[model samples]
Target: MSSNRDDIILNVDKLSKRFGGFAAVTGVDLKVRRGSIHALIGPNGAGKTTCFNLLTKFLQPTSGTIVFDGRDITRLPAAEIAQLGLVRSFQISAVFPRLTVLENVRVAIQRRQRGDSFDFWRSERSLHAYDLEAWERLSEVGLSDYAHVPAGELPYGRKRALEIATTLALDPQMLLLDEPMAGMAHEDVGRISALIRSLSAGRTILMVEHNLSVVAELSDRITVLARGQVLAEGSYDEVSKDPRVIDAYIGVGHG
Candidate 1:
């Protein structure tokens, strides 16, 4: 929403990814303003997931660069990228199924402090140092009531919220969410949507979501990609009306 160039926290220049003979993304440029909720939407197979991987360094790009918080991170490894505060949550609901909700967040906090090694060797009291913050994170995502419940026992939406709690434990400055609403039931969508909005107060979020109504309700800006290239970039009202975007969705049926 801020037009100030200096507020751009993530900048992608001519970003492309290729798989053998297929180019999944091509020369796509993006600018995400700090504290804005930016959505990347497209019909199925438009390379949204590939773009997320490239940005997060899960996959090396064939060309181009990614500048985050004014640092060149195009070639950084995924671990290094995460340490720099660019954390991502996958399309799948990732969590320690057997662990209690509080324990899950605590583990993430441990991961943040102790490199990739978990604190399984530490005593329970030693690990309790993270519980305060873990509880705070659980409270942030409205999961405080389920702190003692096993993650696997929570409903699907609660599992997703637990995933977000783990992500918050990383204390990310910018979060990239891959189809956060992917497996949500109807009631869970609004709950997760509200949680996402609340989380965006002082952070930047770049998400790939298929739920167009959610995008229209949450995004400050939207980028529509088709066939691996940027088809349109603007506000929801602007892109929703674009003939090209309409055609892309209709042609592919937006799987």
Candidate 2:
């Protein structure tokens, strides 16, 4: 499909990453459209995570260019990249254990507003300005009922929701999720899947997921990678039926 330049939120060209002499990702090009859900899927060791790190600036690419919105971000640092409205949610659940669910989101908002200055020592009234917005973010992720509960005490699924809430607090234009359903229970999967869908409204999402069912259900476009290269690109039905994709998955477990 042909996409107008303005319709693309992320443009990657000839992206590659080399750790010493071993190349993990090589000469991959991708374009993520605005306000759409895109999934990156492959068997184990397909370099999905390496590509993610390169995009988020956690690792500098050995070659290629990354453009977001309209600016060149290939050389930008991780913190600067996040400041530019590109945010990442890790595969692990990251939240403050002792802090209330509301507090965790508030901290994220504070970081966005204050640029890394955390003012927990300030008086209660001073931080009240952030509470309303934090509550809104919690409500967005279906966590307002647990506002007062400690983040650590939340169930695993709810904890992931809280992570999404914190991520929303940053107000990202494009969100990169690394394995959002990695360890979720069967019942919780539906809940988180719905939450992810809701979060996609008015924003672009690029996700690296292992669950083929989720990828098929949500992705507008899917990219398949194997042995550090692009294997296929199309809708789920198109790539799932590809002979190479079938061989790759059957030879080594999808993981």
Q: Which candidate leads in lDDT?
A: 1
Of candidate 1, the 10-residue stretch with the lowest lDDT total is: 89-98
| TM accuracy, model 1 | 0.97
Regions of model 2 farther than 4 Å from truth: 91-94
Per-candidate total of colliding backbone pairs = 0, 0
Please report how far candidate 2 places residue 164 from its true position, in Å.
0.6
Residue pairs clashing in model 2 are none
| Tens-digit lDDT string for candidate 2 (1-255) | 567899999999999999999999999999899999999999999989999999998899999999999999999999898889999985223389999999899888888899867877988888888999999999999999999999989999999999999889889999999998999999888998999899999999999999999999999999999988889999999999999999999997897
